[model samples]
Target: MSEWLSVCVAISLLLSLVTATAAYMLYSGLIAHINVLTGSPPIKKITFAYKFRQGLYRNCGQLFRESHNIGPKLPCIGVFYDDPNEVPGPQCRYVVGSILSEGEKDADKELQKRYEASGFQVFSFPEVTHVVTCWFPNRTFFSSLLGVRRVYPRLARYIKERRLCAHPFLEIYREGRIHFMGPLARQGDFYVPEVRRAERRLSEEDELHSDSDVSGVDSNSEYSSGSGVLLSDSRETSPADSWVHSPPQQDGGDRGSRRRSSGEVSFKELDWEQSGGQQQQQQQEGTEVEPRPEPSQKSPEAPTQEWWGVSGEE
Candidate 1:
């Protein structure tokens, strides 16, 4: 009976050792894969004050959104060290990060500065698939063995909540220009709120000026059309008026010439009246009239020769 009990105990101990070794190997493999994929070392420490600052920025973003109808508050991730009790109060470090949307990535420099001043760190993953939080120290084999269970479940929960695909977090430690947080950390000399307001005012003023210009162009077009109609009317009446005002000159012994001239003048008057009536109809109907082609010099000379020939016959 004693021998059977010893064998059972040894078998149980062997199984336990094998399970622990397998877990440790799995944890190491995951860390190695993460490091290769992210191209950066994982952040293991961050300060509590840093997180406090992020909270303030998050509130600011919320308030700004409420007042301006701009954007929702940024989501953040907090990475905690395993043993908070071992670290000193101020020096205790942990990472705080926010995921940026596609649009927010190109936000104005001043706006980014405001966010940075509020104590938020920014990071962008080339292919962001999962949210990462450091629950265990990477250097410790035992901690990693225990942490994988909690870490993976939390990661899975985060992905489920956000409705994201299976993804891993890249470890980011410090601020850099290449990193998304770099832009936010940068400072600007100008006041962001005032500048934004001034830009809005300028835009409004430009819109008003453009509207006035469009109105002026419309009025000018109307005035031009009105003047054109008046000019056309005057042109149609001028020839008839000149003919009526002038008396035909009669030469002695030129009765045939006088008769021919009178006949030509009567024909011209009839033609003019018909043309004027057509123009009036067109104007009243608000339709454009095709312009009459001008008589060539040769045409006028032929008529003058006919008049001379009539005078010679007389």
Candidate 2:
């Protein structure tokens, strides 16, 4: 019985020693792997703040690429470290990847505050750490004036409130500008304008519209006319020269009759009519406009033809 007990004790001790050795080997292997992935050419500890900044930059770049629907162009994510003291550490310390539209971009605001709160010397330029990629589509308006016809009034108001010179999106991709921001962190080199020309136009148009609205006067109204001799003079003048652009004179009788309808025409409609008249005049001068090729075959016209809210063209 004593001999059997001694053999059992020896077996238990040997098993315990083997287990300890195996655990140590696994721990060492993990540490080495992490170091190799993140450690710079010369292995060293990068500052915590720097690492965080790099992480954020990587996050922003990934988001930008994803938004454009062009991923896989970049390999390792590049981050702009906020800490000047923190040198570049491991090349792979940052994760160059993004989750599929499952997170908020503003998630990093708290991170921004954390760094500012810590007070570290980041870099020479103002680090615009907030990550946003704005896009503006082109606008087409039938009558885009500073009056009731203006579309997107809220957007115009917002631009005024911000006092931005232009829409931030326009600055990045202006009409005819090439897109070149790419190549990992090199995309950071592109400076997107905070405001754009469109925003400025909006501000100006809004102010004009508001003033017109408040005075109960449309911009095209006679009351809104400036003190220009051409506008104020009532004397019948000769047809304007070819070089000069002017509203077409309504032919004598029927046109004179239409003058009573000062209240019915909208400001925008009138403006369009006046501008379009110039081209019409240019096309018709010295030659009678052969009546519009009467739509192939004349069909029955609507019994109640609504021409400018009136019965018919006399």
Go through the candidates in order and give each one's C-alpha lDDT: 0.28, 0.23
Residues 197-284 of candidate 1: C-alpha lDDT, one tens digit per residue: 3334533543454445633232111101000000000111121110000122221111011112455446657777888899889989
After aligning candidate 2 to the native by TM-score, how far in Å is the CA of 242 from where it should be?
Answer: 81
lDDT of 2 by residue, 46-129 (tens): 111211222222233333343223222211111211111121222111211211111222223444345445442121112222
Off by over 4 Å in 2: 1-11, 27-48, 51-104, 119-314
Q: After best superposition, candidate 2 residue 234: deviation in angstroms?
A: 90
Report how far off residue 272 is in candidate 2 (Å): 69
TM-score, cand. 1: 0.21
Candidate 1 local lDDT, residue 205: 49
How many collisions per candidate? 6, 5
